[model samples]
Target: MANKKPLILVTNDDGITAPGIRALISVMKDIGNVVVVAPDSPQSAMGHAITINDTLYCDPVKMTEDADHKEYSCSGTPADCVKLATQEILHRKPDLCVSGVNHGSNSSINVIYSGTMSAAVEAGVEGIPAIGFSLLDYSLEADFEPCKKYIKAITEHVLDKGLPKGVVLNVNLPKLKEKEIKGIKVCRQAKAHWVEDFDKRKSPQGRDYYWLTGEFINEDKGEDTDEWALSNGYVSVVPVQFDLTAHHFIQDLNSWELND
Candidate 1:
């Protein structure tokens, strides 16, 4: 019997029309039947937010006249898109879910605030094999050609060998030419954070507002980390889990004299 094509859910934080998602959709079409549910506008660092305070809107959108995939634009976060897709859009549970090819890097601690990885994490929470892809470049016009092969390879591997429950992949590519890329590296998330600076400014009406900016600082000097992989022109793939429980600390907590 011939095997049925895999059903792949596609999404991103850069909106339904962003070049990043478009590039992702193109690659996914070659591998499976793709259905995209993404934010109508950029949702970048929205994390795992969902719509609870206001009405949620999701409508069919025509990305291109000849595009093959089914696409929907939603007035919600990336995480919400995954939830809605599984609950409201797809006829059956998808075989796999993939998010991003995000315009900016979602490596290290940035994953905590990344809408891209949040969508993938949401899928993992629902027991779906998932992955989130990002490039180190932040330019709107960044070339994604270098990532196509790696993305397809990783996606194929996940489909062939299903991921463990609660685990999703975070894949980050370097901003290098295809030939310049060294290879793929499976690694751990690096210990890093942003040193933030808010620029306070006054509008013409004298109202003050702040613009957030930050410098990324890598505190880990370990070579077996995602930061190191990307720095050396390799694609970094980190397995991420949605469970935030500090299970290792529980034993120490039990030893504390809290009962006294």
Candidate 2:
């Protein structure tokens, strides 16, 4: 008897109908049995957030005429979509879980706030092989053509060779044409941060509000970093883990005199 086709769970932070996810769905359909559970609305920058105070809802959605795949839209964050998919939607554990093809880049420190990576990270926490893909372009109509081939290739590779337990992939593609791309590069996450600024304003009714904005500062100059890979026109693939423990400082922490 032949082995069953891989069960691939599809999701994104840009909502189910976004072009980026549609492109992702198209590619996954050719590779395996794809099932999508994503936010009903864009959930960008909602990092690892789940619904606790409110009831969650997930309903089947028909975004395309493709009969080979199933899709659902959830009224929750990207992370919640993953949890709900695995626990309630899927009949069995997915062979692999994939998030994004996000409209904007989730590289460097952005991963800490990205709903795309959060979804993938949630899957990793569940011991599933997962990946989150993103493009540098942020436009709602950004061309995703250059990313399709690479996305399919990377997904196929992950399905063939499972990721290490607790580690998920954060893949960021440069905003370059397919011919201009230098290929994929596996690298470490760069040390970077966002410097925020808030613009204060008053409405006609005298209510004041502030709009938040920031600039990304990349302080790491290493060639083996995700920042360098994306800057050099390569698709950066960073292995991200959910473990937040600073293991290297454990010995130093133990040496501190606490009972004194």
Per-residue lDDT, model 1, residue 173, is 96
* Backbone atom clashes (below 3 Å) for every candidate: 0, 0
Candidate 1, residue 183: CA error in Å? 0.5
Q: Candidate 2 lDDT, tens digit per residue, 12-56?
A: 999988888887888888888999999999998898888999999
lDDT of 1 at 253: 97
TM-score for each prediction?
Answer: 0.97, 0.97
Q: What is the lDDT of candidate 1?
A: 0.94
On the 0 to 100 scale, the lDDT of residue 1 in model 2 is: 8
Candidate 2 wrongly placed segments (more than 4 Å): none
lDDT of 1 by residue, 1-260 (tens): 02788999999999988889988988999999999999999999998888899888999998889977789999999999999999999999999999998999999999999999999999999999999999988998899999999999999999998999889999999999999999999999999999999999999999999999989999999999999999999999999987889999999999997999
Lowest summed lDDT across 10 adjacent residues in model 2 is found at 61-70
| TM match of model 1 to true structure | 0.97
Best by lDDT: 1
What's the C-alpha lDDT at position 29 in model 1? 91
